[model samples]
Target: MALPFLPAEHIPSMFDELDEHGDNDRLDAVMAYVFSIWINRSVFSMECWSIFMKGVRTKNECE
Candidate 1:
């Protein structure tokens, strides 16, 4: 399955908001937000791959 990509325009504002908040606050918020999203997506993708591979193995075993 293909992952939906974020648009380029959306990226600048996230960075801009981070910049406006200054170094400390921005760093904390950015790290928290980015890592949260990253972890969630990583888990989701892993689950998807696990299911897909299981399906493939089941099909192969039947064949």
Candidate 2:
């Protein structure tokens, strides 16, 4: 099975971003920030889901 979010190219970028910080504390901070953004954009708003669904619909239409 394949992953849902993020393309394979983005995975390396994400790991690089995580590695940019010096220590575990800094890495945790970065991850926390990212998690907060994810929660706010994905869980806190219906608009995000609506937009994602639209994208899926468009892809399906193309197919």
Candidate 3:
């Protein structure tokens, strides 16, 4: 079955970006930056959704 709550292909790329620095702490910090920015914003757009989905995919794969 497709991975629960996520499609597989996107997951790898998302995690790949997060892991590119080869440090989990750096990855977490970058992720927190992205999410904190999104959360502090009010309106949602397709562009925002795409960016948010990157975080979602990474979060799911990490789980």
Per-residue lDDT for 28-55 in model 1, tens only?
A: 7765675466434545543333332233
- TM-scores, all models, native as reference: 0.27, 0.30, 0.31
Cα deviation in Å at residue 56, candidate 2?
18
Give stretches of model 2 more than 4 Å off: 1-23, 43-63
28: Cα error in model 2, Å: 0.1
Q: What is the C-alpha lDDT of each candidate?
A: 0.46, 0.47, 0.46
* Tens digits of per-residue lDDT for model 2, 1-63: 111244433443554465566478866776667546643344544333223223555546666
Best by TM-score: 3
Ranking by TM-score: 3, 2, 1
Q: lDDT score, residue 2, model 2? A: 17
Off by over 4 Å in 1: 1-23, 40-63
How many clashes in each structure? 0, 0, 0
